[model samples]
Target: MTFRTLLMASTAAALLAPAAQADVNIYSYRQPELIQPMLDAFTQETGIRTNIAFLNKGLVERLQAEGDRSPADIILTTDISRLSAAVAAGVTQPVDSAVLEENIPAAFRDPGDQWFGLTTRARIVYASKDRVDPAEVTTYEDLTDPKWQGRICTRSGTHPYNLALVAAVIHHHGEEAAKTWLEGVKANLARKPQGNDRAQVKAIWAGECDISLGNTYYMGKMLEDEEQQDWANAVNVLFPEFQNGGTHVNVSGIAMTRAAPNRDDALQLMEFLASPRAQALYAEVNHEYPVSPTTEASDLVQSWGTFTPDDVNLMDLAALRGTALRLVEEVDFDG
Candidate 1:
């Protein structure tokens, strides 16, 4: 047997015993520090040894290449696109668990049970506190106005966060209208789309730009990072259009590998992760919103107040990724 096949077989046998303390292999898109606390909790609670391989890129490719030889039992990532891609690539499986079904909203999980979002993050506007009056701007379309030109800073359109934002637009407006929106956004660029969300805040702080679209958690991280706290402090977060259309929210979720050798353990981990306790920790540690229906926000996050998330179905958002990409490229967003 191939080493992967042998490894999987051994893990399968080991996990089937129920009482057997075995390792749960995870391929995580999050850095170790961000997720280790949860893993440690799991280990402490269940005595299941956790082994992780964390990487920001190429994990999907690596899993695909490893095929059945891949020892991975669980795959974790942020954003629906990667979860969707994992399903499309045949790397994940449909899992049934009452705990998961009860805890996570139907909209945040895959139609086929391929993935489950553990936490959510709003895609809110970060505006200069002293400049933009919060009430004056409430919707995404407002950014396209001529007055906002030379005032926006954002990451590249190709980033998943931007793609998901465009996808939400497509969910509301048709592809043509979505394209028009992208073009308008391109026209408003303070500079060519560059940098991560924190950098956008830095831009506003430095007077390089006055507003930008950013994931809400970046605000928390910037505030917590002593080196970057000033960037976060200088800007006020504006939750757009919760009155008409709710703010766009994205998620970080997980899935059972299609060929998982430790099916039961994988399911247990996923269920435990989706549990109110685990879900709360996932959000608290990473500055995200929990998917568990009953979970509460961390104190720092709670201070941001609450607003309705846009009702756009995340699966629908994932479906529009290709179109969003093409539209972004057509608009020469990369240039």
Candidate 2:
């Protein structure tokens, strides 16, 4: 069957899967199908009814408008910026869960207890196996080499993927260096940024560019893809100079609403999401690395090999949003 068909079928099962239970309600920015399985599994094990309101946009505003009457128990989103936006908007609360703290690594979770990550995805380089030698391409810093000029492809700078990456640079090297890196990268793009992560891979295959930066899971999707698996097959996954520590890691995380009607159930869901059992599902089914230290990668993820993730604190990356955005504008990165 087609991927659209598969996505549709998965979404149906997830939405109806939890209708029978009645204890928890979630206002999620995640698509219904992507996160519903965890909810269904959580409900089956604990009998907590989960009601999810899935929206790709406007969740923060919706929560704010609802205020005290909000039926939201938890908020789920796919990036540090989105989760941080929720916390900054006062829509989330400081959760006091030792179980959660222990399950997720300190590097992945919010220091203030406002948000907890469930899964992580590495933002690494995909170099043309034939064109770029593995040893010479060490860290993200190497991307600036004039030898590889006019051979990079990326999605729009406005994209969250690049924004978070920019934030990461700011975290590791400071704003000035980050700005320089951004300018260097922009100068090297083979074409103006336009498509998603997968498209960058496709460009490499078409000989449009020799390198791209994309999440690890997109590699899995491409290989599994019937029409476009070659998008992934065209290049090799390289974690870039992690010997300094590791590549930069980011997460798709969740938080509890300050006025959650089902606090206990929300807490249970958070705890369950971080459990090894639930975490394995993320890697196996969706291709994201589990944030839980206890969870082993599925065979698919294990095939990608492991590397040390950058030790930069997640909070600092989240706090750099404004500086990152301003730099993006200053560089005319979108153009």
Candidate 3:
């Protein structure tokens, strides 16, 4: 064969040689835009291409159905319940990573290493700066006081965020106290739990309510939107605590699927997410507190002021989620 033909043949063969297999497939419950930047950074740093399937619901069932044939290497999601469910469903395998251990706190990770939290967001109170005295709402327990009747607002009680908070209440004070607290909070709502966290702030601005329950990050989101900036401006972020513990908080976390096709590449991506660089990106994009002690929260989040997060194990919150939902129904929290 001619030299030119031989060289062309060799080049074509090299180009078609299965592409070196540098990709990690992810089954994610987190929204694409919120996680895309960090995934891009991971790819840029490590050259491991990311293939993600964003699912709003049914991730666990889907993973179970795929079984051993699943192409997913990682499961990315928010809320401890989903992470814990993945483990209970036997769809995740334990990871023993020194990098993960060093970066994530024990409370933020599964004891068996089945999952790891990347960031935390506090469930806090947003009180009207113009009409409400911050002193009137110093604790989650205080929101139930008759003095605040018809003065509070919130999203549905069934939202994963509120369910986690209710679960925390159960973990701290027992099921009975949690049920009572749920009913009390319900009795005080200005309107039947009607809108999202930001909408609750808008309600406060519109004089529809004086205080509302929300995640700290929503305040940052509201501030970034011109229409919602006024709503954000009308409220002061309040870090209400448990009567005996710190503020209730939730997380966005990661897990390795049981059928990981690229174990080494998946491990690299998991460790990268736990690193300071990825933690900082989480803080920047989602306005959440970094799970790593070495990473700092964004300045805007810091400006909202800081508070002590409750030391309750997130797994406990996940464990009690069923009871929390039942209590929400018992109280007719949305009705």
Candidate 4:
């Protein structure tokens, strides 16, 4: 079926489903399958049915367009900027859940309780096991050193993942310093910034570059894919700090919709997600770090040596997105 048709169908189903069903309608950027396991567990535990309408783009616009009629109770998405964008668009409401406050770290959630982060993936270095020494690249700042010139690979600077990292740089150091770091990293690019995180690892395997920046979970993902296992084995996941801070990280988060029809159920699901069981379940499903301090990452994820996550509140990094993009453009990072 066409996407619009499916969206309308999901919306209609949500609108028509009996309230007695005790269901929570979710509009998620996360694929349904990726989260279905946890949703199933929620249903098994609380008897609350979960319905999700997955959308790749225009999530904020769709919620805004639907206005008070939006059937969405929760917004499930990745990245701090997208979460902040929904808040900025007036589409999400502040949730005052004590459970959420206690479960998620303050740095991972909105200070106003507008959104709660579920999982975090660090932006880290993937170095050639054969060519690069683990101790050589220990911090984000070291990637720009002259010794590593023409030895890095990355995707587009304009992508949200990279932008978030750049935003973190702006948070730690000043703007000029962040820009110069961007420039230096750009100068050191093996080719131009031109592929996804996995591709960068493949580049490293092919001897295209010695090291690249990628989220920590990509290592697990690569290892699971038979074709990519070789690529995965070629590199060691290295968590890089911000010189003055810890490793830069980003989150996949959820928030309540302003016009939630099932507010109580939504809050129930939200609270359930913050529980230790759900936190670990979700983290294991995605091969990521759980945001709840009480929960530990899956064994596969923990095998990747741990590092401190940056202390800056993600909302602070979200605020710097505009400046980060402008800096990327000014540096002609791709040029």
Candidate 5:
């Protein structure tokens, strides 16, 4: 069936489902399968049913269209950009919860408490084990060196993941320097920016590029896929740092919608997500680092080695997104 048909069906199902006495409705950008386990646990623990509609794009517009009558109590999404946009668009409301404040680092949540990051994934380099020396690529700036010309692979510059990384570069080094670095990396491309992070690893396996940029969690996902195991095995995950800071990171976060019909239940679910139990489930299912300092990464993710994450507040990254996108266009990085 077409994706549109499936999406409509899901939306219909969500709208038609009978509401429980205590329930929360979520409009999520996260895929259902990845989040269902946590939702189930929340329901079992709190007796609060959850109805979710997964949308790949246009979440804010949909919420805006529904206005105050929207059934959506929460918005669950990946990347700081989306969360920030939701707030900027006035589709989400500030949440005041001590549980969120205690479990999540201040850097991972908005100052106004509009959104809270549940899990984090670093934007790290994936180097071909046989072809690239790990010692040679220790930092993000190293990718721009002339020696690595025609050695890097990446997705489109406009992709939120890459933009967030570029934004961090801008955040640390200033706009002009970030632009130069972006152009240098673009010049070093093994091919025109294309495909998702995992595809870049497959490129390494095929000898298409010596290295590529990808999230830390993808390494775990690739290892679990039988057909992709060789691709995963072909590369060593490298946690590259900023020249003066730690590795760049991004998040999958949650926020309460402005028109939350079930405010009490929604707050309960939000607090539950920040709890140790949910954090552990996120690590296991999503291969992401939990936001809570007390929760450990899954063994598979832990085995990938560790590095200090750049302490740059994610809200700063969100702020520079426009400049980052403009720089990407200025350089025609994808071209």
Candidate 6:
């Protein structure tokens, strides 16, 4: 099965089908292009037609509204907060699969098995190769130094990616320290926190700032786009670690829906996703580190270099999300 042959459903209702269809439905926050190859491979191997309904937001609310009638079999999303939100909303069910257990690391999966991480991307620094000395930015705490004032760039502080990083700071240091650090970073902003990670890289290319915080994979993405290639080339990927910990990382993960209409097929897809073959394919396509301990990152991802991942359980960071958001607002990080 190829990308064209894979059934791409426009709505969740289209996924409702008889048992003979051998299909699985997905409610995914991930873009279709990023997962197309993995879906095509799954269809070819399992003969299970996949139907995905992509949504930018409101997935948990939609699933809650649909209740048992939801046609979605699995929920695919990035970040631990969203995954935990679905579980808290009573939209996801625990999955007990030996294949998943064997493939994904304990730190990357939910304690209750409500979600399993598929890939991880580090919250790293993107430094201007021309203007910034790599030694100047070595850890997350260094971003707050007085020397970097008016020299840093970042997305909105309240964004989930930044919140997770803030949460990790709270985990390593105390809440008060994290707030001070956030304030220092805010003071260093080249402009009001604006745009996505890629935009921050573009700013570096334009000489708007000396360094920016972003996920490692955006370098790979920028390199792939002809127009963005220059933006990517302008920066060097730097993995910043916590003061006493390793690099801060977040995940893109999956979970079975509570009302999984096609439970068997969903399980098959979930298991296949955690398998080494699929993990490798996902890593190569998305330019993220595969959660499967046995799978190595793609050649392009490896070329960016390496860092020891922080050993903190991601659920702990998810737990601190509310407080993290409050800190962002308290400091007026975007202002």
Best by TM-score: 5
Question: What lDDT tens digits, residue by residue, belong to model 1 across residues 15-112?
Answer: 34443454688887876678889988988888777766665688778888878877778988988888899888888889988888999989888878
lDDT by residue (tens digit), candidate 5, 14-53: 6546665327888889988789899999999988888778
- What lDDT tens digits, residue by residue, belong to model 3 across residues 271-331? 9999999999989999999999999999989999979999998988899999999999998
Using all chains and alpha carbons, the TM-scores for the candidates as numbered come to 0.92, 0.90, 0.92, 0.94, 0.97, 0.96
RMSD of 5: 1.7
Better of 5 and 6 by TM-score: 5
Question: Residue 252 of candidate 3: its Cα lDDT?
Answer: 92
Instruction: Please rank every candidate by TM-score, starting with the best.
Output: 5, 6, 4, 3, 1, 2
What would the per-residue lDDT of candidate 6 be over residues 1-335, giving only the tens digit for each residue?
Answer: 65533434435546666545548889889987888799899999998988777888899998999999888999999999999999898999999999999998899899999999999999999999999999888899999999998889999999999999999999999799999999999989999999999999999999899999999989889998999999999999998888799999999999999999989999999999999999999999889999998899999999999899999989999999999999999998988
Q: Write the per-residue lDDT of candidate 2 for residues 1-335, one digit (tens) a residue.
A: 97546654554245435434446777777777778788788878887778776766898998898897777788889888899899999999999998988898887888899999988889989888778777767788888778777999988887777788888878777889888988888888899998889988888999999999899888887878798876777688888753345687788998999888778878998898888888988677778988887788788878878888888777787788788988988988768
Residue 228 in candidate 3, Cα distance off native in Å: 1.6
> How many pairs in model 6 have backbone atoms within 3 A of each other, for residues 3 or more apart or on separate chains, i.e. clashes?
0
- The Cα local distance difference test for each model comes to 0.84, 0.82, 0.89, 0.91, 0.92, 0.91
Q: After superposition, how far is residue 141 of candidate 3 from its true place, in Å?
A: 0.3
Error of 1 at 84 (Å): 0.6
Q: Give lDDT: candidate 4, residue 294.
A: 89
For model 4, residues 1-335, the per-residue Cα lDDT tens digits are 97656765665466557766547988888877778899999999999998888788899999999999888899999899999999999999999988999999888888888999999999999999999999999899998999998899999999999999999999999899999999999989989888799999999999999999899888888998999999999999999998899999999999999999999999999999989999999999889999898899999999989799888878889999999999999999988
Where is model 4 more than 4 Å wrong at Cα? 1-22
Q: Which stretches of candidate 1 lie over 4 Å from their true place?
A: 1-22, 242-244
Candidate 3: which pairs clash? none
RMSD (Å) per prediction: 5.3, 3.6, 7.9, 2.3, 1.7, 2.7
